[model samples]
Target: MTLKICVAQLNYCVGDMPGNAQKIIDAARAAYADGARLLVTPELAICGYAAEDLFLRASFIEACDDAVNRVARELAGLKGLTVIVGTPTHGNTGRGDEAAGGLRTKSMAVQQRHNAARVLREGEVIATYAKRELPNYQVFDERRYFTPGQGICVFEAGEGESAVRVGLLICEDAWFEEPARLTKEAGAELLVVINASPFHVGKGNEREVMMQNRVRATGLPLIYAHLVGGQDEIVFEGRSFALQADATLAGRAPGFKENMFQAQVERAQAAIKIIATTEPERGDDAELWDALVLGVRDYLGKNGFPGAILGLSGGIDSALVLALAVDALGADKVRTVMMPSPYTADISWIDAREMAHRLQVRYDEISIVPEFDAFKASLAGEFKGLPEDTTEENIQARIRGVFLMALSNKFGSIVLTTGNKSEMATGYCTLYGDMAGGFAVIKDLLKT
Candidate 1:
C-alpha cells in the first residue's frame, strides 16, 4: 500500500484566521488533485505560530476554531484524504470558567488552550494531539500560554490494505523522546510532526541530526513539516523532511522557502519505504542570506510596513544591513539617511553616498553638527570645565536618531536599527540613539 503525503510549507500571518484558512484549503485542494492521501501543514498553521498574547483573547481562540472548522467544511468532500491542520484549541482539562461569555464553547475554558494539531476528515475532527513539551528557554515562551498535552494521537488513514497508521506531534513535542516513543509503541507506522521552529546558523543541520536520532530510536518513518515565514523577530526555515527507520534522508524540502513537498510512503511486505526523495542543494552562507532576506520581507509585509528606513554609517554593520534591506524590501522601498558628526571622516560620507547610489534607493545626508553643538552648549553651564567624552558621541548618535525617527513618523516607514553583537555586548551603542528603532536586523548575530 502506497500513501502519498503532501507537506504544505506556508507563511501564515498572525491573527489572520480567514486568510490562513483559505491558504490551507487551497493547499488541500492542490494536494488532493495531485493524488495525495494525506496533507500536513506547519504547527499553528490556522492562526499562525508564536501569536504571543493573542492566545489570551477569547475572541481570538473562537475565531481560530471557527476558521479551522471552515477549513474542515470546505475540504470535506475530498473523502479519504486526511488533513492535519495546526491550531490552538480549548483543552478538555482544567477547572477554570470560560474567559468570556459566548466566545468559546460553553464547557471549555479559554485558559485551558492547548497548542494542538487537529485531524480533519469528512467535515469532522477525528482526533487531536497537543504539544506535550512546551519550550520555555531563550526565544521561546510557550509555557506561558499552552498547557502540555497528555497522550498521543495515532490514527489510521485510508481503509483496508492501503491504510497507514499516522501519529501526530507538534513542534516541541518532537524534541523529547517520550512522545515519539509512545506514539511508535501505540502502533503508528509513520509519524507526522508539524513545527514552527525558528532559524539560526546551522539550525537545519542540527534538526536533521535530531530527526535521525528519533528515527533510529522509534524505528518508525517520520515526516517533519516546518513553517516558512518571519513573524516579528523569529524566522521559520521550512526544510520539511521525511526519513526512513534506518536514519536515511528519504525526502526533503528546501530551507527558507515556501513549498508543497510530496513523498510516497509505501508499506511493503517487510517494511515501509519512501519512493520519492529529493534533497535540495545546501550551503551555510547561502542559507544565512536566505534566512535574513525572508525574515525582513515577511516581517515588513505581515506587519503592514509600507517601507523601511535605516541610518547608513558607511561602516560594515550598516553597510550589510543596507544591502539586506534593499534585497528584502527592494531598492525603491528602502530609504537611507547618512548623518555625519564633527568627527566623521570625509571618506565615510563618500562611501555612504556611493553605496546608496549603487543601491538606487532614496538617500539623504543630514549633518548632526548643529544638534550636537546645541546639546553641548545647553549642558555647558552645568559642566563648565568638564572635558568632552562619549557623552558627546552619544549626543551625536541621538541627533541622528531624531532625524531618522522624524522621517519615519512623516513617511510611515519602519526604522531598521543596525547594531552588531559586539557593540551591544560592550555597551558601545546608545540606548535611545543607535538602538532606537522598531526592529533590529542583527541583534543575536555575532561580529565574526
Candidate 2:
C-alpha cells in the first residue's frame, strides 16, 4: 500500500477554541487542496497543550468536542483524506469503546486524564486512541488529570498514494517501547504520533535522534506531529519530521511557525525528494540562549512579577543574572543593588555598575560595614567561645541580604538570587543572606 500523509504542526491557543478551530479548518482545507491523502495534526491542536486547569471544566471540554465536530463537518466531503487530529475527547468513565473489560484495574486507576486523537475520514469519526504513559514528572501532571488510554487504535486507509495499515500514539507513547512493539504486533504499516513537546534549546535534535532509534527498533516508518507556539513559560517549537522504515529522515517542517507537509510511503521504495528545506537555523548555543531568554521572560511574566531586583556582587554569577533579567524583562523593568563589604573587590563594583548602566537598568549601592560591626557587637556574648571561622564571613553576607530584601520590599520588586550550583553545593552561600530571595534564578543547575 502506498500512502501520502500530511502532518499539520499548528500553534494552538490555551482557551481560545474558536480561534484554534479556525486555524485547523484552514490547514485541513489547504492540505486537501495540495493533494494530501492523510492529514495529521499536533497534540491538542484544537484545545491546546498543557491546558492545565481548563481540562477540568466540562464547558471547556464541550467546546473542544464542538470544535472537533465542526472541523469534521467543514471537511465532510474531502473524498480522499484521512485526518488525525488531537482534541480532548470526553467519556463518562473517560474510557473508549475498546477494552478487555469495563474495569480499568490497579495501575490504571491512578490518574484519569482523557487525552485522545480522533481519526476522521471523509468527515466521520473512524477511531480514537487514549494517551498512555501520562508523564507525571516535573512540569507534567497528566496522571492527576488524564487516565491512561485503554487500547491502541490501528486502521487501514485506501486513499493514500498506496493503501497501508497505520497505528496512532499520542505524545508519551512514542517514547516507550511497548507501544511501538504492540503497534507492530497489530500489523501497523506506519506509526504516527501527536506531541506538544516543548523546546529547551538543544531539544529539537534530541527528539529527532530518539525518533531515529525508535524507527530502527520498530522497523516502521514514523510520523511525528508536534505543537508550535509560546505557551506560558514554555515554547513549543514544532520541528516535525518523518523517518522511513529504515530511520532515514524523509521530510521535516519548520520550527516556530505553523507548517504542514505530506509523506508518501509505497510498498516499493517511493521516490522521496530532497527539496531544499529551510529550518530555523538554530545552533546549540543559540537555542540554549533562546530557551533561557524565554524561560526567564515567561517565568516572571506568568507569575505576575512587575519587575526583578538582584544583588549585583559584580561576580560572574551576578553579572550574568543581571544581564538575563534585563534581557527578559526590559531594562527599565530590572533594578540592581550593589552591597559592598570590606572584603569585596573594587573591580567587582566597577564592572557591575558599568554593566547595569549599559543595560539602562536602575542601579544603587549600600554600604554594610557599619551594620556588620553592630551585628558583631550584638553577637559578641552569643559567640563567646566561638572563634570566628566562616561565621564572621557570613555576617557580612547576611547584612547585604537584608539590605537587598529591604530594597525589594520597598520597591515592590522581586529579589533574584544569583547563586549558581557551584557555590550552592559548596555551601559558600549564606542562607537568609545570599540565599534569601523571592526567586532563585539558578536553583536547578548542577554544580560544575
Candidate 3:
C-alpha cells in the first residue's frame, strides 16, 4: 500500500500567532487536496520559530496553545488527513515536595515548556512528541527556553492493511543516533523530522549527510521538513528532502523558496520503499546568491517597507548592494544617491552615475563639501593645536549620512547600508555615517 506525504516548506514570522496558524491551515487544505494522507509542517509553525523572550510570558504561551487548537479545528474538515505541527507546550518540572506525614507528594507538573510536535486528526490532538535533545551552541538556544523530554513517540497512520508507524522528531533530536534507534525499536516504519534550521554556507549539504546517516542506522525511511524565510539576521533555506532506508536520496525541494514537497512511501509486509522526484543540486555561489536575495525580499516585505534607498559609491561594495536591492525590490522601488565630498575623484562620479543609469533607478548627486567646510570651521577652535587628521574624513561620511537619512525620513523607504563584514570588523566604517541604515544587507559578508 502506498502513502502520500506532503512537506510544507513555508516562511513564518515570529509572534504572528493568528497569521501563522492561518498559513498552516491553508497549507494543510492544499496538501489534502493534492491527495496527501500526511502533512508535516516546520518547527514552531504555530507561533513562528524562536519566539525568544516571548516564550517566557504566560500570555504568549497561552496564545500559542490557542493557535494550535485553532489549526486543529480549522483542519478538521479534511477527512482521512493527518497533520504534524511543531509548537511549544507546558511540561512537567519533575520536582515535588514531601508531605508533612513523610509521604511524597505528586510531582509538580506543567510548569516547564517543551519543544513539541503534535499529531492532529479529526479536530483533536491524538499524540504529541517532545524534543529530547536541546542544542545550545551557535544560534540555537533550545536549552535556555525548554526542558528535555524523555521516551519515543511512535504513532500509526492510515488503516490496518496499509498502515505505517511513523516516529516524530523535532530539529535537534535527529542529530543523535539514540532517538531514531529507540524509535525503530518501538515499531516505527518511518521517521519525520521537522526543523527551522538557519542558513549558512554549505549547511544544506551538511543536513543531507546527517539525515542519510540516521536512515542508514535505523533502516527507516526519513523525511525532513524545514522552514524558509528571513528573520532578523538569520535566514532559513527550505530544501526539505527525503531519504530511503538504504540512505539514498529520495526527493528534494528547492532551497531559499517555499514549496510543497511531495513523496510516496510503499509498505509491503515488513519492507518499505520511498519514491520521489529529486530536485537538481545548486552550486555554492548560486545558493549564496539566492540566500541574499530571499533574505532581502522577506526582511523588507514582512516589515511592511515599500522600497529601499542606499548610498551608491562607485566601489564594488555599494554596487553589489544596489544589484541585490534591485533584484529583491525591483528598480522602480529602489533609489540611489551619490554624495561626493571635495576629495572625491571625478571617475567615482562617472562610474556611480553610469551604474545607476544602467540599473534604471532614480539617482541624484549631493555634494558634501559645504557641510565638510562648516564642520571644520566650527571645530577649528577645539582642534587649534591638533593637526588635520581622520576626524575630517569622518565628517564627510557623516554629511553623506545626513543626506541619506533625511531622504529616508521624507520618503517611507528604508535605508539599506552597504558596509561589508570586513569593514565592520576592522572599524573601517563610521558608526552613524555608514551604519545609519535600517538594514545592513551585506553586514555578514566579507570582501573577497
Candidate 4:
C-alpha cells in the first residue's frame, strides 16, 4: 500500500498568531483534499520561527497553544488526515512505560517552554515531540527560549498494510545522530523533519546533505518541510525535500517560494520506497538573487510599507539597490532621486536618470550642491584653519539624505539604504547621511 505525504512550505509572519494559524489550517485542508494522508508544517509554523523575546512571555506561549488547538479542531473533520504542526508549548514529559501507552505525560508544575511539534488526528493530539537540539550559534537563539526535551516520538500513520511508523524531529534535532538514532531504535520507519532554517547562499544544499547523512545512518526515508519568506532581516528559503533510505534524492520543492511538496511512499514487507520529482538544482546566483528579492518584498510587504524610495547616486551600490527595489516592489511603487553634489560628474546624474527611465520608476533630480554650500558656510567659522577632508564629503551625503528622508516622510515610502558590508564595517559610510533609511538591502553584501 502507498501513503501520500504533503509538506507545507509556507511563509509565516512572526507574532501573527491568527494569520499563521489560518495558513496552517488552510494548508492542512488543501493537502487532505489532495489525497495526502499526512501533512508536515515547518518549525514554529503556528507562531512563526524565532519569535525572539515573544517566546519569553507566557501570553505568547498561550496564544501559540491556542492556535495549535484551533488547527487541530479545524482539521478534526478531515478523518484519517494527520498533521504535524510545529509550535512552542509549555510542558514537561513525565516518566512512563513506552510499551504500555505513549512516552509523554503532562506535568502541571513545570512551565518551561519547549520547541515542540504536535501530531493531530481526529481532534486530539496523539503525540508531541519536543526538539532535542536547540541551536545556539549564528542566527539561532533557541537555547535562550526553550528547554531541551528528551525521549523519541514515533507514531503510526494510516492502518493495516498501508500504515507507516513516522518519527518526528524539529530543525536542529535532525542535525545530530543521537536524535535520529533513538527514533530509529524506537521502531520508526520514516522521519519527518520540520524546519525554519534561515537562508544563506548554499544553505539549501547544505541541509539536503545533512539530512542525507541521517538517512544513511538510520536506513529511513526522510521528509524535510522548511519555512519560506523574510522575517526582519532573516529569510527562510523553503526548498523542502525528501530522500530515500539509500540517500537518493526522492523529491524537492522550489526555494524562496511557498509550495505543497508531496512524496508518495510505498510500504512493503521488505522495504519502503519514496517517489517524487527532484526539482532541478538552482545556481548560487539564482538562489542569492531570489533571497534578496524575497527579503526586500517581505520586509516591506509584511511591515505595511507602501513602497520604497532610494537616493540613486548612479554608482554601482545605489544602482544595484534601485534594481533590487524595483524588482521587489514593482517599478510603480519604487521612486528614485538623483541627488548630485558640486563634485558630482555629469555622467553620474545622467546615468542615474537613464537607468531610472529604463526601469520606468518615478525619477527626480535634487542637487545637494546648495545644501552642501549652506553647511560649509555654517561650519566656516568653526573650521577657520582646518583643511578640507571627509567632513566635506559627508556633508554632501547627509544633505542628500535629508532630501530622501523628506520625500519618504511626505509620501509614506521607506528609504532603502545602498551601503554595502565593506563600507558599513569600516565605518566608511556617513551615519546620518548614507545610513538614513528604513531598510538596508545590501547591508550583508560586500562591495566587490
Candidate 5:
C-alpha cells in the first residue's frame, strides 16, 4: 500500500486556540483533498507553541483542551486518514491522576508531558508519542515544564498492499542522534518531524544541515516541517524540505512563506522522491537585502516604533545604510540629513540629495561649517602646544552626535547609526560620531 502524507507547515499564533483549530480543520481538509491520507502539523500546532505564562492560566489550558477535543471530532469523518499533532495535555495532577481528574488516560505521558504528540486516527486519538528529550539551554525551558517520554510509537499508513510504517518526532527529537535511532529501532520506515524552531542568524541553512545528518544516520526518507512568521523578537523562516536517505535534498519550500507538501511512500526501497528544490531564487545581495528588510519590518512592528532617522554621509557606508533604511521603513517613516564638512566633496552633497530624492526619504541639510570654526576658536588656546590630530577630528563627530540626539529627543524618532561593520570593528568610528543609535542593526555583524 502506497501511503500519501502531507506535511502542513504552518505558523500559529500563541493563545489562539479557536483560530488554530480552524487552521487544523482547513489543513486536514485540504491535505485530504490532495490525496494525503496522513497529515502532520508542527509542535503546539493546535494551541500554538510555547504558550508561556498563558500555560499557567487555567482558563487558557482549559481552552486548549477544548480545542483538542473539538479537533478529534472534526477529524472523525475521514475513514482512511490519520493525523499526528503536538499539543500540551493536562492531566489531573500527577502520575496517578490519569484515572483521577482526567489526566492522560492512555500511556501517553512519557516521563511527564512537557511535550506530547497526539495521534488521531479517523478523528479519534488511537495513540500518542510524548517527547523524551527536553532542551534547556538558550531560549529553551522545557525541562521546567515537561517530563521526558520514554517509549517510541510507529504506525502503519496507506491503502491496498502499500502500508508503510512511519515514525513521528517533535522538533528537538530529530536534532539529537538518539530519538531517530530509537524510531528506526522501533521499525519505522519513514520519519516525520514537526518543529517550532526559532530563527536567528544563519538558522535556515543550519536546519538543513542538521536534517542532512539525521537522514544519513537513519537511512530513511525524512520530512522537515517548520513554522513561518514572527513572534515577539524571534522570526521563523519556513523552508520546509524533503530529503532522501542518501542525504540528497529533494524539495524545499521558499523562505518566509507558507506551503503544504505531499510525500508518497511505497513498500520497496527506492530513491526518495523530492517534490521541489531545483531553483535557487534569491541572490547574495538579494538574500541580505531581504533579511535586512525582514529584520527592520519585524523589529519596528514588534516593538511599536513609530519612525526612524539616519545621518546620511556621502561615504559608501552611510549611503548603504540610508538606502537600506528607506527600503525597510518606507520613505514616509524614514528621514535623512547630510551634515556636511568643509572637507565634504561637492559631489558628496549632490549624491546624498539625489539618493534621498530617488528613495523619497525625508531630507535635511544641517551644515556644521560655522560650528566647527567656533569650536576651533574655543579650543585654540588649550591646544596651543599640541599638533592637529584625531582629537580635533573627534570634536566634529561629537558636535553632530549632540544635534542628532536632540532631534531624536524632540521628535520621538529613533536615531539609526550610519556606521557599518568595517568602521566599528577597528573602532575607527567615534563614540558619538557614528556609534550613536538606539539599535545596532548589525550588532553581531563582523567587518569581514
Candidate 6:
C-alpha cells in the first residue's frame, strides 16, 4: 500500500493568526484533494518562525493556541487526512499525564513553553511532539525562549491495512541522532521533520547531506517540510524533500517557492521506500536570484508595505537592488529616486534613469547637492579648518539617505538599502547614510 504525504512549503506572516490559520486550512484542502493521507507544514507555520519577543507574551501564546485549535476544527471531518502544524505551545506535562489517565503526580511549578508539533485528526489534537533540542547557535535563541522537550511523538497514519507509524521531529531535532533513533526505536517506519531553517548559500546542499545521513542511520523514510519566506533578516527556502530508508533521493520541491509537494511512500520488505519523483533543477545563480526576489516580496507583502522606494545609484549594488525590487514587487509597485550629489557624475543619473525606464517603474529625481552644501556650510563653523575627508563623502551619502527617507515618509513605501556584504564587512559603508532603510536588500551577498 502507498501512502501519499503532502509537504506544505508555505509563507506565513508573523502574528497574523486568522490569516495563517486560513492558509493552513486552504493548504489542507488542496492536499486532501490530491489524496494525501498526511499533510506536513513547516515548523512554526501557524505563527511564523523567529517570532522573537512575541513569544514572551502570554496573549500571543494564547492567540497561537486558539489558532491551532481553529485549524484542527477547520480540517476536521476530512476522512483519512491528518495535518501536522508547528507552534509555540505550553509544555504542561502534568496535564498530558492526566489526559493519559494518570493522576498529576508532579507539583505545580514554573510554566514551561516548548517549540512543538501538533498532530491533528478528527478535529482534535491527537498527539503533540515538543522539540527536544533547543538550538542556541548564531541566529537561533531557542534556549532563551523555550524549554527542551523530553520525548518523541510516534503516531499512526492512514487506517486499516495501509496504516504506517509516523514520527514527528522539529527543526534542530533531526540534527542529532537521538531523536530520530528514538522515534525509529519506537516503531516509527516513517519520519516527518518540519523546519523553518534559514537559508544561507549552499545550505540546501548541506540539508541534503544531513537528510542522507539521518536516513542511513535510522533506516526510515523521511519527509522534510520547510518554510518558504523571508522574516526580517532570515530567508527560509522551501526545498521540501523525501528520502528512502536507504538514503536514496525520492522527491524534492523547488526552493524559494510556495508548494504543496506530494511524496508517495510505499512499504517494502521490512523497510519503507519513498518513490522517486521529479526533482526540479535550477542553477546556482538562478537559485540565489529567486531567493532574493522571494525575500523582498515576502518582507514587503507580509508587512503591509504598499510599495518600495530605493536609492538607485549607478553602482552595481543599487542597480541590482532595483532589479530585485522590481522583480519581486512588480515594476508598478517599485519606485526609484536618484539623489545626485555634487560629486555624483552626470553619467550616474543617466544610468539610473535608463535602468528605471527599462524596468518601467516610477522614477523621480531629487538633487541632494543643495542639502550637502547646507550641511557642510552649517558644520564649517565647528570644523575650525579641519581638512575634509570621508566626512564630506558621508555628507553626500546622508543627503541621499534623507531624501529617500523623506520619500518613504511622504508615500508609504519601504526604503530598501543597497548594501552588499563586502562593503558592510569592511566598514566601507555609511551607517546613517546608505544603511538608513527599512530593509537591506543584499546584506548577506558578496561582491563577487
TM of each candidate vs. truth = 0.93, 0.72, 0.95, 0.95, 0.72, 0.93
Query: Mind giving the per-residue lDDT tens digits that candidate 5 earns over 156-253?
Result: 77666666777888888988999999999999888888888876656777888898999999898888878765565455666777787777887776
Better of 2 and 4 by lDDT: 4
Regions of model 3 farther than 4 Å from truth: 92-110, 384-387
Candidate that would win on lDDT: 4
Instruction: Give the lowest summed-lDDT range of ten residues in model 5.
Output: 270-279
Error of 3 at 413 (Å): 2.0
lDDT of each: 0.88, 0.78, 0.88, 0.90, 0.75, 0.88
How far is 210's C-alpha from truth in model 3 (Å)?
0.7
List model 3 lDDT by residue over 325-391, tens digit each: 9998899999999999877888889989988999999999888888888898999999999987788
**Model 5, which residues run further than 4 Å from truth?**
11-25, 44-81, 87-113, 120-127, 137-146, 156-163, 198-206, 230-235, 266-286, 302-309, 325-348, 365-439
* lDDT score of residue 331 within candidate 1: 96
lDDT of 6 by residue, 1-448 (tens): 8888888888989998789999999989988888888989899989998899899888888999999999999888898888899999985544445443565645633578889989999798999999999999888999999989998999998877668899899989899999999899998989999998998778887998898899889888888899999988788989888887788788889889888888887876666777646567686788889889988999999889999999988888989999999889999899999888778888898899899989999988887778888888899899877998998999898878888888899999999999999999999999789999999989989898
Local lDDT at 74 for model 2: 85
How well is each residue in 296-369 modelled by candidate 1, as lDDT tens digits? 89988998999999998889889989999999999999999999989899889999999999999999988888
Residue-level lDDT tens digits of model 2 in 1-448: 5556777887677777887888888887887787677788898888877899888887888898898888888889888678787988667543443455766644443323488988888779899888987898868888777778869889876554577788998888988898888987998878888899878657888888888888888888888888877676577877888887777777777766677756766676633222213354567666555555555665566557789999888777888788878877899899888888777898988998888888999988888889988988999999998887888889888888888888778877788888887788787789889998877666645544
Q: Across residues 1-448, which tens digit of lDDT does each residue of candidate 4 receive? A: 9999999899988899899989988988998888999999999999987789999999999999999899989898998889998999996435654633654545424568999999999799999988999999998888899999987899998766878999999989999999999999999999999999999989898999999999999999999999999988999989999999999899999988889999999976779999987778789988988899999999999989999999887789988988888888999999999887887988887899888999999988877777788889999999999999988988888888888899989989999999999999999899899999999999999887
Span of 10 residues, lowest total lDDT, candidate 6: 91-100
